[model samples]
Target chain A: MFRGIVFAFLGGACITLQGVANSRISHDIGTWQAATVTQLTGFIMALMIYLFVRDGDLGGFRKVKPLYLAGGAFGSVIIFSEVTAIQTIGVTFTISALLIAQLLVTFLIDRFGWFGTTKSKMGAPQFIGLAMMIGGVLIMKL
Target chain B: MLIGLLLAAFAGMMVALQTIFNNRTDVHMGSWATTTWVLFMGFVASLACSLIFEGSRTFNLQQMQPWYWFSGLIGVGVVICLVLGIKILGPTFSVSVTLTAQLGFALLFDSLGWLGLEKVAFDWKQLAGVVVIVAGIYVFKFGGKKKSAEAVQSASAAN
Candidate 1:
């Protein structure tokens, strides 16, 4: 439990850090080029890590759905849309909308068991918790 | 403004979608291998787009600072952690926790004016926001302890 929380927390921190850094890189290179560079360096780093900590079989890729391979395609879209939104609407509104949107989509995914995920009904506490979380974000941004 | 808001939401959807896709990919391969594969594919796609869209622009790497390169490395961390996190915490819970941390750090950076951002004063509202988010998580996890574990199991199993 602790490990999961920590993992989620660290992942979140990295998201912000990477975004700020990527935007900075975009200022230096063009937006798309910055993305390419970020992905390239990230790929290199992942390749290095995979060498030492190779636990899973690479051949397993053949077992997964072909559509799953397109995850990286969405990665590019995430970068392009996020940067443009921030630039257009200002950071506060952009981030607020983003948080809400993420919560809504993720909650629906959890409820409906989308993409082969387990369907977990949002109990009263979970729903309230989500609402509070969303409220907190709105408060922070507004 | 509406378009901007829509774009932000669209980005959020892409993020959620990408995460699940990565998690699905992780089911067959090791986390690191999945990360490597995703980044490799992303690199190719983005490289192609960059060539097509940015062919005319020449980047002068001479003035580029060292820290700019670190984003990709940080991205490696993000993917690994999310892969682990989603497996354990499930999709919504994992992402909610992550989003909290993301916002918290962003708030801290904004307040401290780190990363070249203009300094903003930290006040009670920010503190309340953080506190409420923490409270929400606490409520969702421990407050409903009876259901939480089963919820987690089902989510992971289904994934």
Candidate 2:
């Protein structure tokens, strides 16, 4: 539990960094260019590390099903779309949209057991919590 | 502003789904391996998009600022931290905490003008929202039935 809390904080910090970086990048470069370039750089870095350590077992790239591959594609699109939106809508709004979207996706995926994972049933509290989060997000922007 | 918020939310939710997928399938490959594959995929996808959308635009790495590079590094760090954090903290809590922290940092940066954001005053409503959010987080974390019930029983016994 202690460790979990630490992880939570650290994760939060990292994400904050991402937000700051994204904001800065958006100001500097075209939203698409910035996002794509950053992702590419990160990808190259990750790939390099893998090459050095994994002894050339790039099989994970090949092992997954086509739909799994689609996850990556979808992720890119979502990221680019959000970044573009941030330029027009403002940061708070963007973040709020993201939070609500996350809650909904998580709820559905959990409840439906999509993508070969076990389903997560949502209680009333969870639903209420999701709504509260969405409301808060909107309120923050407003 | 509202539209931007919605877009950001949509993007975040998409990320969440990806995370769920990662949790399910990532065990087959360790974090290092999984990160590599995802980054590669993202790279490929982004590159393709860039080509299709912005044809003939030379990507002159030399012309880019240091922030761009730092941004990517930060992204890598975030990915690692998020993966590790999700393992320790459940998804909902992890995401909430992360976003809260992001907001906290964002405010500081905004105030300091560190990230090129102009100085903006934090109004009463923003403060109230922050406080309310903190309270909500506390409730979500400690107000669970088991913990609350245990506390109530212990207090009753003492009384």
Candidate 3:
């Protein structure tokens, strides 16, 4: 848990900013169009960095599964669904549902060691801690 | 409303799965390359959807700020850090911490009204929520591990 805490926090902050930015962009053009622009710009930026770094073994590509290579497609649906949900159910409910679902999926993934992740054993303390976190999220909405 | 909630939840699931899957790709492709590949895939998907559903509306860039168009660059930072964190801490713990950090930013954003997001009045309830979440993480990290942690450390040392 402690490992890569900085990276984790930074990732979260960046997501928030990106969400706000996406919303603003969508307002200007259109939702899916905004998504297209986002992905395009993101790809370009990442490609630039990759070329500059000149790292990672090309041979290791064989080690990665084909299905995982398409992971980025999820972003399109994520953008589309989340925006529609917010419009239909409102921001508060959308945010709450999003957080809960995310936590639930991640928790299940950890407990089952799904998709090749390390299995995490949960005891009473872990459960209690998780409950508290959920409570905190709900409270934030309230 | 139920459908809306379901859609929201499904989006959440995608968010989680996307990170995990992207991390797996990162293991082989390296950080920047993995990010590039993921974004490229996303671009293809979004473009397809745009053409099919969004169609004519998709191309109308009618005099919007060019700066806002660059927002996607921020995704570069988000993906790289998330993959790095997941590599070290595993998905669940890493994501939980990420959520906490996000809320912290939310608080800051709300207080300052940054990026034109509505300025939410600072309230004790929101403050308490932050406190509780932090406490939860503290418990998850170090609670009930005093003697057992020491014992494990010693056991490992002896091995």
Candidate 4:
């Protein structure tokens, strides 16, 4: 329960800034450009932090493989686009749409065991809840 | 209009992909390592696309201001927090609460005209939308039926 509270609070903070960051990226560069740059910047920062904190050597990176890297790139494009949408559709609506999109995609992925995700069974509640969430996002559109 | 809608939908799909990948990768690597790989790879991909389409001449670092980099750094913090939250709490609960909180924060930021953007006043449609979204999240959180007999029996005794 305690961990859950901390998670909720941290998640709240992260989501709070997500809109501002997205809006900034949109204005600073073209949607695609901003997304790409942010990813690079973020990646550089993360790598530097790892180097200083972790005792492991650079050899571990060689094992990362190109396929995983490509996967990351594809994911980055999606993230960048989503953030850009927040500016156009407002945060509330964007998030609602995101929830629906995520649920459906997750179902597909899990059902088919795509992208290394676990092959889990989707319960009835999960489907209904996802539908309700999507319906809510649609309502927000109005 | 339809084009824009489709693009947004596509972006939403991307976001989901990122989440799942990040979730899986985070297990093997720490958040920083995972994030670095994601961002660095993304940058390389973008650069390649731009260079191929717009040519190598498109690589102009001078065009970007310092503030642009600062904005990216801010995003780094946001990502770390978000990842931490997701790791600690399940994605469903974490995303639901965060989305609700984000709406409130984004509204406040928009109202203040901070970050040099045009100010948008609160309106009825926006207000109603936010309320409905929040309600929906709560409903989604608690709407599930009974769990498996084993889950129910264990869950009850655990508390």
Candidate 5:
């Protein structure tokens, strides 16, 4: 549990770092080019790790649902929207708004068991937690 | 204006959905392979989109600084960390913690003017916001501990 929190923190830091790097690259190149380049580099790095680990079978890829394979496509949309939103609304607002939106969708997803996820009903505490987080984000932007 | 905000919200939804998909894929393929597939597929999708929308103008590779290339490498860290996090922390907890970290680091980055971003002076409001967010996470974690634990157990049992 402690380790999970630490990993989650690190993951968040990586996202911020990636966002900065992406913005810099996008300024020099076009947004799409930057995204494509970033994806390519990430692919190469992951491929290298895969080669070293040699854990999962190539055959497993064929067994998974096609919808699962569309994550990358959604990633593309995320990049495009994130970059554009930041430019339009500033980083603080964009991040805050994104968080709120994310929590809302995540709540619905969990409640409904959408997208192969298990249904977990949200109680008052969950809602309060989400609201507090969103409030924090808004305050931070102010 | 509102449309842009709506788009941003949609993008956030996409992010949540993407994580779900990636997590599911990770169960089958392992983290490294899953990351590889995601990046490769994203690269293909972005490339096609770039070609269609930007056309020949999209290829400006020579103008970019060498350091800019590190974004992709950092992306590897993001994928691996997220997969590990979700596996352990579950999606909501992982994502909430991640957002807190992202906001904190983003504020720091802005203050330092790192990575081509213009410097923004640090404000107490932001600090307060960070505190509130951390508090919220604490509440979320402890308040719903039993429920989340049960959910996690059930999820693993399902698998």
Candidate 6:
């Protein structure tokens, strides 16, 4: 559990770092080009690791669903939409709305077993926990 | 405008969905391999989109600083961390923790005026918010365990 929280925190820090780095790159190249470059660099890095580790079978990808394979495509949309949404709706509004939307969808997925996730029913306390978290986010933005 | 709003909402859902997909894929492939697959697919998709929409536009890669190129390395870290983190913490908790940390770092960046970001004043409210988020995590941890255990049992039975 502690390890999980630490990983989560590290993931968040990486996000900020990546956003700052990507913005700089975008300023030089256009957004799409920057995205392309970033994706290429990431691909290379991951490829290097994969080659070194050589753990998983590349051929196994055929067994995975096409929808699962579309994560990368969704990632592109995420980048594009986040950039535009922040521009249109202001950062605070955009972040708040996005987080809320994310939480709601995650909850539904867990609760209803949608999108290949296990169904985890939420109790009142879980709902309160969620509300409190969202409230905290709103407060932080204030 | 409505379309934009819907897109924004969809975009948020996509983030969650992407995480779920990546996590599932990670279960089959190792984390590094999964990262490679995702990046490769994303690169191809974006490259195709760029070619189609933007035509052939060239940017002088030589003029850019070396540090800018490292963003993808950081991105690789984000993907790996998220895949592993979500597997352990579950999506909701993982997202909450990630957001809290992101907000904390964002506030730090704003106040310190690091990385060319404009300085923003920090007030007590922001501090309070951070505190509240921490409390919320505790609340969630305490509140959700029983339900989650039941879920696991039911899921196994269904399978």
Among these predictions, the greatest DockQ belongs to 5
Off by over 4 Å in 2: A1-4, A51-57, B58-63, B86-96, B110-113, B133-159
Best candidate, TM-score: 5
Each candidate's chain B TM-score? 0.66, 0.71, 0.67, 0.72, 0.74, 0.65
Model 6 agreement with the true structure over B110-148: per-residue lDDT tens digits: 566556544557667766766676576556645655444
lDDT score of residue A50 within candidate 2: 65
Q: Report the number of clashing residue pairs per model.
A: 0, 12, 0, 1, 0, 0
Query: What are the Cα lDDT values of the candidates?
Result: 0.70, 0.57, 0.68, 0.56, 0.72, 0.65
Candidate 5 chain B least-lDDT 10 residues: B150-159
For candidate 2, the C-alpha RMSD (Å) to the true structure equals 7.7
Candidate 4 differs from the real structure by a C-alpha RMSD in angstroms, to one decimal, of 6.1
TM-score of 1: 0.79
* Tens-digit lDDT track of model 1 for A1-142: 7899899889888877776666667766767877777888888988898888888877899998989877867777677777676556544445556666765576677678877867766678867876886787667666
Residues A10-99, candidate 2: write the lDDT tens digits: 656666556656666756655556667777777777777667777334565466666654555554676676666645654444554565
CAPRI quality band, candidate 4: acceptable
> What is candidate 4's lDDT per residue for B7-68, written digit by digit as tens?
55676576556666555555456556666666676777776665665564445555567766
Best by lDDT: 5
Comparing 2 and 4 by DockQ, which wins?
A: 4
DockQ winner, 2 or 3: 3
TM-scores for candidates 1 onward, in order: 0.79, 0.80, 0.78, 0.76, 0.86, 0.79
Error in Å for residue B10 of model 2: 2.4
Ranking by DockQ: 5, 1, 3, 6, 4, 2
* Candidate 3 Cα misplacement greater than 4 A, ranges: A1-9, A57-62, A84-97, B1-8, B80-97, B111-113, B141-159
* TM-score, predicted candidate 4 vs. hidden true structure: 0.76
